[model samples]
Target: MTELAIGHVTTDCAHAADLAGFYAALLDRSVDPGATEFFATVGRESGAHPVLMFIQVPDRTAGKNSIHLDLHAPDVAAEVARAIGLGAKHVADFAEYGAVWTTLADPEGNLFDIGTGQA
Candidate 1:
């Protein structure tokens, strides 16, 4: 069988550059050059899958996101604070599975989580 890997994960937004910029700052990834208002990317496109990609859309995705990203941080609270500073809104907090995590919405309302890895 041919090897399979995710080339990129894309999300649609009214303006690609805005969403891409948010993720890039949040993930500490670099925005690829030549990005236009219609499309943009975070992370180096030359190597690997580039991790994330964004495309412009007429309307935002409706309802809750069917898929979301769960992030890990040594200090969940501090990370959450930083994310909020970066324009992420705190959605809620969860304590289960022997861990604690906080859900946040990006500038475009895409959901993601930040958690304390150890107990």
Candidate 2:
């Protein structure tokens, strides 16, 4: 038998409140009240289980991000433009191994890729 289970993923952020809010707006979900400085979860019970945790880290993001999220978009090109207008900047142009994808970074320098379908 094959059983698949892994713990949730959390991203470290400098400000819990600010980063939580950023994710809330980006994900279009309300922030979980249980969220604190050490942790936060978006879409807590909506099946996304996508939690963006904020831990008190001294370092501000500099250079390339070691970890990043890949957000699926209905329209990769349009979403890339929209995200850029919303303060996200293009880190790299569109590229693909088998699907379309674009690399972008948030205002806080967290890197994420937006794409349509599967890559």
Candidate 3:
């Protein structure tokens, strides 16, 4: 059997550098110096087991994102507020599952989820 080891996930973006910087700031990590026009990686030493990779694309994104990132927070309400203040637009709110999660879209229209649960 072949063991699978996850290293990183690269998300496609219309503006590579700009989107990469946004994530870098959000995640509080610097973009890898060796990164190129195609991709950027962050969270190399933030104590988070996993890292994020933002990939650049030439075309502009349109419509809704087919896939999105789901984030966990201890305080969903507070986190959602913070995210909104950071240019994220609210898409939906579901609070009946003993958990509150909000879907949001970034400046490039890519969707990501933020909620309270897990670490």
lDDT of 1: 0.84
Task: Give the per-residue lDDT digits (tens) of candidate 3, residues 1-119.
Answer: 87986677668876666666766765556776666767677765554446777788777567776767788877888877877776778899877658668888877778888887643
Q: Which residue runs does candidate 2 get wrong by more than 4 Å?
A: 1-4, 34-38, 45-47, 60-62
Itemize residue pairs with steric clashes in candidate 3.
none
Q: What stretches of model 1 exceed 4 Å from their correct place?
A: 46-50, 117-119
lDDT of 2 by residue, 1-119 (tens): 86965445566677666667666777677777777765667765565654556665777667777888888988788878887876788988675678878888887778888888686
In candidate 2, which residue pairs clash? Answer: none
What's the CA error at residue 20 for candidate 1, in Å? 1.0
**Per-model TM values vs. the true structure:** 0.88, 0.76, 0.76
Clashing pairs in 1: none
Quote the lDDT for 63 in model 3: 75
lDDT of 2 at 81: 83
Higher-lDDT candidate of 1 and 3: 1
Q: Which 10 successive residues of model 3 have the least lDDT summed? A: 42-51
Candidate 2, residue 119: lDDT:
64
lDDT of 3 at 79: 77
lDDT of the structure predicted as candidate 3: 0.73
Please state every model's RMSD to the true fold in angstroms.
2.0, 2.6, 2.9
lDDT of each: 0.84, 0.73, 0.73
